[model samples]
Target: MTTAIGNPYLEGNFAPVSDEVSVNDLPVTGTLPPELNGRYLRIGPSPKGSGETGMSHHWFVGQGMVHGVRLRDGHAEWYRNRFVRGDVPEDSPNTNILAHGGRLLALVEGGGAPVSITPDLNRMSTWDADGALRAGFTAHPKTDPATGEMHSLSYLIRPGTEELRYVVMDATGKATHAAELPVSGVPMVHDMAMTATRVVVLDLPVTLSMDAMGRLAAGAPESGDALPMRWNEEHPSRVGVLPRGGTADQIRWFDAPRCYVFHVLNAYDTPDGSIIMDVVRYDTVFRDVFRGPADGPPALARWTIAPDRGTVSEQIMSDYSVEWPRINQAWAGRSHRYGWFGGTGPDSLRLSDDVSRDRGGSFEPGPLVKFDTATGEASAHHFGTGRVTQEPTFVARPGAEAEDDGWILSVVYDGTADRSELVVLDAADLKAAPLARVHLPRRVPFGFHGNWIADNEIGA
Candidate 1:
């Protein structure tokens, strides 16, 4: 569905697939672990039809489609991809998919309510925790391993005011608590960090702009790619630390560097009352190009916030430009030793949709990187030259004792074959060859976030 003119996101692997596929017993190259019995589910933008093409087709604002692989025993059972829509397809949740509170949900941020889907990817309907969620829900919600509760901060994408809401969903999928916090502007809080006692809010400088929305409304040429947000210089970049179960007035604010963080690897509190947050940081985003986040390459950085001193420190953990960080769910909101990331170079448009200019960023295939936060060392697994990978989901082995005792699964797209495969790697040994490769039915476009849902956690 490419057009006469060009938009980078609408071409190649980023282009949306038009068909809904359900294939059983997909081909496999190696053996799937007998203990690995669940589904590796991922969702991303998959716009329908050929009407929305060209530069106006922003990558973030597309219809969501869920792609999943079901595995049982040592067999690769099936692969399915379905649009994440209920009665109305426009408000489908497309950014992330996860199982929580006995319900499986497809999620989107910036004011869209989450939509529940069945185990087989069938659309169920809009979910609001039985009407408890009055505002929008965030795509990223940090689950507390101690209590199985999920916490998130939600805000409207097209905000007219300057406020955000902090919500806590209990283990039973009920909204336990919610509070409002006043802010400078409607900052695009893409993700938040959670510690044992606090939920850290990233109040960065990127904000909603009425001017950009006006351009899209007027049907301006090249405005098809215009996102409603821009890099706001007037907005002060800071982080808000709200105590667990505390009100907005008790939040402590500390200044941060003028940058953007799309994902937080993990965050935890130190004994001395400091917060350590690992994240993929961008120097700037939504700047000159209103299309995507191509202002600069994203680097893995750590931000240490000290409320007692009202100061924050920044340090680069890995300079190898990576994103989509995942760790063992057991270490969530706690100290962790290892994390997996997808590598992207300075080239490849730097996550930007405008490929009109020849940026030095390389289009070559990237490696799946295994990062050790304790030693600042990275080991990468290359998928050859013609292949690119999305986020790597780490599934720990049953009753595993070691932190790295698990399997890393990622969807790798091969440009040479115009196809995709699920690559499996021993989490402890990235230098070794893949343990298995599950051949998918078709190519899977680079998407946002996904999780490995075990059968015991939800069901088969």
Candidate 2:
């Protein structure tokens, strides 16, 4: 029997044209070459989801050029267009685009090596010293700020068992080492994070008994019940930190819960040789599989490492309701402070005693919270009940910039009009009104990640 499926690509009334504007109905110029002097570069899949049989969704790299509007006296027009198209498949949720020195690195989802897009957004032709394709490949590549070297880790699933072997690569595209890791109940190696000096792998070692149709049969439901899943009295989560130059025996392991269902939203290195990782630890009894809330409002824990002494310390910075899970956090500045924003959800006061009755599910309007890392003092700025602000991208203003402050650019959802606006806030005082709100013609769909391209930069 054939089951009827709803069209996943249904169109909605999300796009809104800006008012106080004469060009009321400018058509969307799809997949066109970008103009020069554009400031922003965005990389994502083509509008159509990846379901077409033979054709692949075009991976787009777009540039936004800001121009003074002659029609609207004081306003400006930001023309965005795609400059490059690649057939790389983006099956995973996260893709990365980072500007390193003069070259742009594009990391697609599938198992290809990382691709290098030149300042012009065109794919580069040169291979690295190891003779690997420098462009149009896949791998998670992150550049070290101090040394400017690129590091990546890739893994392949073992043929007959639930295990994976990883290959670590350096800036010159050379495979430095290989090792095997047990995969219990966790997802594939597609979900991993890395720093300049270390690679962190999250794995679960429990085998799932399956039926004739290959569906999971009855087994222990909780991750903690998995035989090989690791947890300890202090950390209570399984984490493996492999140093870049260390031998297999020198690799360090820590216990930490899997916070999110199948992904690690963010992870970064700290100055004091610690790692801060965000995870969604499963709260089994309270979590609902179909319509239930997310697994956690995961906390950002500090994992301190003492290579010489062979020790690690895990400390939770802050934890909140599961409804308002904090996803991303960044160091604010010299004060050693950090600020983060929670996911969509209603105010805590509005949550009913019974969670099933709560209307909060996906992205509900939330607030931005700032914390003093040294003192653990925290404060929040809730935009409001109907207005949603999210995916804040913070940048330090150039020059002799304020050592303790930066600028935050976020997408604001104005519920009343069902439209979205770009809101810029002073990181120091988030409670203040946005410095500017550039009204958009439609809802910029919720996005995973973004980086700022300053105006004075060469490409812009």
For each of the candidates, give the backbone clash count.
6, 20
Prediction 1 TM-score vs. true? 0.94
Candidate 1, residue 52: how far the Cα is off, in Å: 3.3
C-alpha RMSD between model 2 and the true structure: 9.2
Best by lDDT: 1
lDDT of each: 0.82, 0.40
Off by over 4 Å in 1: 1-4, 49-51, 221-226, 346-365
For TM-score, the strongest prediction is 1
For candidate 1, give the lDDT of residue 113: 85
lDDT of 2 by residue, 18-128 (tens): 211222322322211122122333333223312321111111111111111111122324423232333343222224555544545555432334445555443343223
**Residue 340's lDDT in candidate 1:** 91
lDDT tens string, model 1, 217-240?
A: 787745433457888999999999
Question: TM-score of every model?
Answer: 0.94, 0.62
